[model samples]
Target: MTSRCILQTALLVYFSTTVLAVNYDLLRFQLSSSSVECQNLLLQLNGTTKDCIKDRMNFKFPEEIEKPQQVQKEALLLVTLDIFQKTSDIFRKNLSSTGWNEIIVNNLLEKIHWQIEHLEEILEKIKEEENFTWDDRTLLPLKRYYLRIVRYLKAKVYSICAWKIVRAEMLRSFFFLDKFTNYLPN
Candidate 1:
């Protein structure tokens, strides 16, 4: 046993720098050497090699699964944002017309509801996962969120402008009431 330990120690010193040199062929040769302890040690080393391989494989598989999950989530958000931008263009075109006000308001409200729901869902997912996954797809969700925010602000501005016009018309109509009532032919 002492001689076997000495032999293994000497081999370790010789091969210390070469991590890849521990192969089946080299191990088989060592196992067949005269020392019983060397043979047992070679079997134990084989188990360690298997464990190292398993750790590497386990490390790579999750990355493969996680990457595409990120892409899928991000693509959904990007497409949702794009649809919003196009829908915004329509709202922008129609904002000046009284005829489109009710329909646009309804549509804008629905879009707001959707954005809120999606944003909540996204936030919930992030909270739930919390560093379990990372993806390039995140850019799209964040961008979509930006688009929705812009849409919301634009809608509010249009509503304000439309209300201002209505308020001006009401003021003009009332402006004559006091003067006309007081100047009634006596």
Candidate 2:
């Protein structure tokens, strides 16, 4: 009877860990697919718009994330999550005023929002496994980057050309994220 109880307990623990790991993998896969979808949608929107090369802003993506290979996996995940969260907020606040096709812009927002939620789930799992907390200060550079973009848009009065440049920049961001995911440990 004792042996039987021990066997059952061990099996339960094994299956629990297995399921948790599988869930993490599933979330990552879903996030990858969603990221690709976002890129395609952005590509389509960018293609339809006139080039705004001269309207480029002086802001840059955070240098820490520029080289994903050198960053720790947890730091990468946290920073990526922060970027998506900020991007979603910026999109919700600005995209509607851009005079673009409403349906496509809304669809893009929905995908981005979904990605944020998915990243949150992945973050929670990583927190549990790694027992670590991320510093908010790490996101200072990203916040500054977004702040500059927002100020630029406001200064331009959210003109179509300005929005076009922002849209292209977002496309570039998604492209980077898609590539960054490849470097993450599976």
Candidate 3:
């Protein structure tokens, strides 16, 4: 009876430990997902500006920015900030062109800045729930919330690009009309 009880107790301990084991895969997945999300956001923004301004502006997104895997595990925040800085620099350079209107450029910058902030917040949320299992009911809400934030950023970028194109067309028309008027007999 004593041996049987000891075996049962040992099995119980083992099962409990397994049940409480940390899921490192989930943590790594979160990190990877966040990194990709950030990269996608920057790339989309780059594409938007490029499409809006076309050959009227010269710009390129930095394609070699470091990924999350390259970041030191202990310095996640610092590396993440570095990533944002590089992307932000690209954005500023693109918008500072003399061709783009100041008001539209400022609006674009503000949208990107807020998007970056939101991305950082999402990363924090992921980190806080690193130990959660994939099947956890809590994870569903978390993923849904994060997806909504991503969609919001994407929509804002699209809107800014659309507006830029329209504004550019209006300015061009005004300039052309002004030139035509100048050529008229007066």
Candidate 4:
């Protein structure tokens, strides 16, 4: 029957769509793996939580980044912590030499929990008020700064750990590394 034919066609379309949706992330991972920059960026973004978990669990840095730059590694770890705090989900995996990942994961989760509470308070306050005093002028700067934060964070990820090789002087500026910015005389 015609009705049966329509149902079959619809079902076929739906099946294909759902299958693609499920594999979207896997496709992203696969495509990204082909390129060095893409892989590193993915690693930087995903590795934030992974590395932090490793750090907390006493996971040692991968031999790749565990070179003699002790100061560089420590400073970069601070940067790593900041980015990790901004993003991470449950079901974390360890990527370190030690098992200190649990402690840091707990800490990161606690911070996220508190942030949700704070957001709730803000939402409640917004509902109670019709308009914020000086809202237009005051909120614009905040919005700009928030956008800047996003770019700064991305730049840090790409230029640092994500890149095959990134320079300290270059990264120093992202975190306000003023010392490296000093002008030199010829």
Q: What is the C-alpha RMSD of each candidate to the true structure, in Å?
A: 34.4, 2.2, 19.5, 21.4
- What tens digits encode model 3's per-residue C-alpha lDDT throughout 78-102? 2333334433443454343234445
Candidate 1 regions with alpha-carbon error over 4 angstroms: 1-74, 85-94, 101-104, 130-186
> How would you encode candidate 2's per-residue C-alpha lDDT over 36-139 as one tens digit per residue?
89877776674434466677775797776677887776677777787788778777765655666778778988888888887788678868876889887777
TM-score of each: 0.25, 0.88, 0.28, 0.25
lDDT of each: 0.36, 0.75, 0.40, 0.32
Cα lDDT of model 1 by residue, 1-186, tens digit: 999999999899777634423232442232223123212322222112232332221111122122333335323333333333433343344445333345535545454345445534543554454433434454444344435534443555544343333223222222322122222111
Pick the lDDT winner: 2
Model 2 TM-score (2 dp): 0.88
Show the lowest summed lDDT stretch of 10 residues, model 4: 177-186
lDDT string for model 4 (61-94, tens) is 2222223233232222222222223333211322
Query: Which segments of candidate 2 are over 4 A away from where they belong?
Result: 22-28, 46-51
Q: Global lDDT for candidate 1?
A: 0.36
